[model samples]
Target: MPQLDISPWPMVILSMIAALFYFIQLKLLNFTFYNTPLSKPMKTQKHKTTWELKWTKIYLPLSMSQ
Candidate 1:
């Protein structure tokens, strides 16, 4: 078998740090250039009937029995 040649530890560490920094820089640039704010808060519909409360009251004991 042939012997393997590996890079030094400092080079590996520096490469990982550089990659991390580049990813963070890319994310920051994308957020700055493309982000937009919502014009208005979303409106939610109000429930006319309390259907969940009625179902839970009827089914809670039935489920617990099993």
Candidate 2:
């Protein structure tokens, strides 16, 4: 095999560092960008009546239940 003029160790180390950096960047980007926000969509009704019914049932007074 023909001899290389420069040692390949520095290139190898640089490539490894670059790869690690890219992986971390992609991980951070996906975490921030891919997750949907918890806000209700515009088309869906807020359903305030349903929420009130559920909560009222969940916290009904003992006297009321008797």
Candidate 3:
């Protein structure tokens, strides 16, 4: 039978917690914020083409007798 030693685990856990707090403090101290410029509404134009103004017709081959 063998016993596992975990005496160093407490020190490691404390160091990790200290590092987390240090990073959190740095993030809070160096925080920056900026306001975005407001965008203006754009105007849309409506126009018609020459093709739409002319009338078109389509003939079917099945309607014609042979």
Best by TM-score: 3
Q: How many backbone clashes does candidate 2 have?
A: 0
TM-score of each: 0.37, 0.39, 0.44
Off by over 4 Å in 2: 1-6, 33-66
Poorest 10 consecutive residues by lDDT, candidate 1: 54-63
RMSD in Å for all candidates: 14.2, 12.0, 7.1
Put down candidate 2 lDDT per residue, 3-60, tens digits, no spaces.
8767888999999999999999989987854677698767966766766666444566
Model 1 misplaced stretches (Cα beyond 4 Å) = 1-7, 33-66
lDDT of each: 0.79, 0.80, 0.88
Q: Residues 17-63, candidate 1, lDDT per residue (tens digit)?
A: 99999999989987856569768977998876877556553355655
lDDT pick, better of 2 and 3: 3
**What lDDT tens digits, residue by residue, belong to model 3 across residues 1-66?**
889999999999999999999999999889876789899897886678877898877666997976
For candidate 2, the 10 contiguous residues with the lowest summed lDDT are 51-60
On a 0 to 100 scale, what is the lDDT of residue 2 in model 2? 92
Candidate No. with top lDDT:
3
Query: Model 3, clash count?
Result: 0
Residue pairs that clash (backbone atoms under 3 angstroms), model 2: none
